[model samples]
Target: MAKIKEKLGRWLRVAIGGPMGIIAWGISGASAMAIVVWGLQTVALPLLMLKTASWGIWGLGVFRESRAKRENPPPKV
Candidate 1:
C-alpha cells in the first residue's frame, strides 16, 4: 500500500533523472572538448611547428660543425 507507493515514487524519480543527468554531463563535456580543440588549433599547434622547425635547423648546424671537426682534427704533437 503505502510502502509500494513510496517505492514506485523513488523508481520514477530515478528513471527520469538518470538520463537527464547523463545528457547534461555529456553536453558539458562536449563543449569543453570543443573549446580545447579550437584553442589548440588556433594557438598552440602553429607555435609548436615553428619551434620544431627551429630545432631542426639548429640540429643541422650542429651536425655540420661536428662533421667539419671530424674531418680536420688538430695537428698532433
Candidate 2:
C-alpha cells in the first residue's frame, strides 16, 4: 500500500509537476500558431505530441515502481 502511494506521489509529481513549463510553453505557442494560422497543424501537432510523450514517460516511470516490488516480493516466513 505504501509502495503504491509512493508510486502515485512520484507519478503525480513527475507527470503533473515536472515538464509543466514545457507543456505550458508548447500550449501557448501552439495556441498562438493556431490562432495566427488556422491551417498549420504540423507545428501544433508536434507540441501536443511532446506533451503526450513527456507525460507517458512520467507515468511509465511511476507505474514501473509498483511492478518492481511486485516482481521481487520479499521472502515470507
Considering every candidate listed, which one attains the maximal TM-score?
1
**Whole-model Cα lDDT per candidate?**
0.53, 0.58
lDDT tens readout by residue for model 1, 1-77: 97679557655544333444345445445545655878755656555655555445445545554555568654564
- Candidate 1 wrong stretches, greater than 4 Å: 1-42
Query: How do the predictions measure up, each by TM-score?
Result: 0.41, 0.36
Candidate 1's TM-score reads 0.41
Q: Compared with the true structure, what per-residue lDDT tens digits does model 2 show for residues 1-77? A: 97679667765644443454345545556556664776556557765675676556555655565555568765563
Clash pairs for candidate 1? none
Clashes of 1: 0
Best candidate, lDDT-wise? 2
Candidate 2 collision pairs: none
